[model samples]
Target: MSSPSDSTACDLYDADRPLNMRCACGRNHGRGAEIEVSPDDKLEASLMKALFPVDSVRRGFLRAVGANTARAAIASVLPLGTLQAMAQDKAPLEKTNLKIGFIPITCATPLIMAHPLGFYQKQGLNVEVVKTAGWALIRDKMLNKEYDATHFLSPMPLAISMGAGSNQVAMNVATIQNTNGQAITLANKHKDKRDPKMWKGMKFAVPFEYSMHNFLLRYYVAEAGLNPDTDIQIRVVPPPEMVANLRAGNIDGYLGPDPFNQRAVFEEIGFLHLLTRDLWNGHPCCAFGTSAEFIEKNPNTFAALVRSVLTASAMARDPKNRELVAKVIAPAQYLNQPETVISQVLTGKFADGLGNIRTVPDRADFDPIPWQSMAVWMLTQMKRWGYVKGDVNYRQIAEKVFLLTDAKKRMKELGQAAPEGAYPKFTIMGKVFDPAKPDDYVKSFAISKMA
Candidate 1:
């Protein structure tokens, strides 16, 4: 039995190749040329080339010092072995144990389910999906770095990055959590006042000032020919408290995340007045993101986290897994909502609180692609509503914050078809929004708060 070190030079070289082709160690080595060298292998080869400018010098030095001695010397001098190892598989992840924050909403389905479904564990990560009190708390904890990553309103990352609502700390939206899963749920008493014209002086609740729920509610009412600012009042209420507020008569209705919207119906307090999907079929509702600093420091860990969430997103996207997902995430450790209510939201077939069963399968969807156009749309809305002012570089900010490149790579890695084009046109309330002309889209809104 030949020892590893006693192997012939040709055999040693052949070991590195995919196929064992015995060839002289020369410039034109035989069939071994066809073998692909991995990144780590390339690193090692490059280092060897740099260390000895002449091939004869390298061979003589290796022959003199021996392979084991040469490896020890290289490792001691420059950490060549470590560098090669890192180049091979992403440096063993900068982090393994992580604390992620989330609100108990269906928008966080992928993130929440990742914990119970062992997706994080599969990625060699121990993730704690801490159920936060509300969106504001989630934002605060994320900003403080109390939680490594958190569920964000799709607009929140953009807002945070631009310093619109909080201190400008660069954030990145890794993937959209859910889309078209929100609804304008009104109190049962307001059933007679379905028209926005009759909603004058009505108090409404939104999860956050910088949330898609707020933007969608504003747009919906504005399209109904009512000024969202003065004609109706919009308060920032947590989703968990939406049903309670509605039942207490403190709020007339809320455009909130589920299963709160569906929970209201189950509790006999509110009716689903309108699904946000009716206004925009594929509107982004929430996002999974972390600070840009975190990603820079822990690229591998962040990639693993993205893979885990995207895997969960892929699972959540299938209609067949909706019931199972609802069951998996409806426990006290997760969403903490009734399984039936959560099932109704995830399954997309539920009582509208008006005694009729409504079926809209895409009512709550888990599309993880973080399209840049979606960010552009959010920016346009932000400009239209005066959340942002002055000349806005729509595409620049969209690309910076949305992480479209990262999303595309991860989606492709998971065998999902990545969406083409960063700026795809979308229609909101029948108005075409071309991302190329975001300023025009903002100007086209008649009932805007833009100065």
Candidate 2:
């Protein structure tokens, strides 16, 4: 076979013809056509058609300089060889059949929906999204490598990477699965005590210690001049059991993921005390991610996986698709909850359990962009709450753990505009969280567990 440098340059930049269309040379070509041809084939066809627009002149030129020289000339101009290699480059998947784990909550919508919607199959992947019991089990399975990827609490990856709750394993957050979808639910008895100051001495539940729920809950209570570690009793309870705990009065309230928060309101055991969105609007709740080793071992598979989830996230972001997404992921195979409960969480329209119907369309959103600032903030909280002990390299860990680059690329691939920047300033409860000065931010907190 003639080397790429030896091939002649073909004038294949046709403005009118579709990229995938067959050229006059009886070969398929196009600029953006959805043709089945490999990238190399497409490039070759386009080049041949362009170089020899008039078959007689092209034949004469090729006969003179030869095909190899022509290729070298073309390579010198457009780097067609490199482009063709990229187009045709299909990285063989290290593993195709994969098991991904996710909790049965609205926060895991993108990952769960990807399966039913055939997004995984579209990328030549066979993904089994196992409905995990809770966040702790999900973490365990991930560390054990029983699950290749998982629905993670946005902070879990950071904590896991640092060996906080599990052995130190480098993990990466592929995307923020859902944001601002969590709520602090209180037993109906505490409805009269609507203030956080009144929450002192009350027992509250969070899905995991290394969860956004925990951090946000602590921040919310601390901002009220109450110590999260001493003033309030915070317990690690699985989300599905939160409502039950509320019903049994096992816990006074919980800052947890949906549809459990909504489920509590549905069960009439608790009222929506406050949405986490109220504490920090647009806060990231959960993430879609896997271990760093997995990404390193299967780069293409991971890329395809990120693209599939990003596609699902793009669909889930649309309000028009929320109701449909609710139905699709509500079955026993996925969330295993009432469709109405899931719908309320996904659509952002639900009863506040006080007879008021609240409508906040962005109450829960699948933004998919894993902002590094989010990770930075989580680190600050981890430091604030004594999760990570000494001087923490906040930005380095944030960049290492959150796959912002991959998330942005996949978002763009799915026609979504990726948000710019590594660390964006966030206003949590009216206080600016400058990720640049996390230690200062931690020091600013009055009721932290920090000594």
Q: What is the TM-score of each candidate against the true structure?
A: 0.80, 0.80
Residues 1-451, model 1: lDDT tens digits: 1123544322222322232222223223544334333332343343344335355666676678776766655444332322223234444879998999998888999898777555675567888889889888998898999999989998999999999889999999999999899999999998899888899999999999999999999999998899999999999998888989999999999999898899999988889999999999999999999999999999989988997788778878988778867767877778888989999998988999888999899999999888899999999889899898889999999999999899889777666689787878898888888989888888777799973
- What is the C-alpha lDDT profile of model 2 across 307-355, one tens digit per residue? 7787778777888777767867877778789989989988888999999
Backbone steric clashes in candidate 1, count: 0
lDDT of 2: 0.80
Please tell me which predicted candidate would have the highest lDDT against the true structure: 1
**Stretches of model 1 off by over 4 angstroms after superposition:** 1-91
Model 2 error, position 278 (Å) = 0.9
Query: What's model 1's overall lDDT?
Result: 0.81
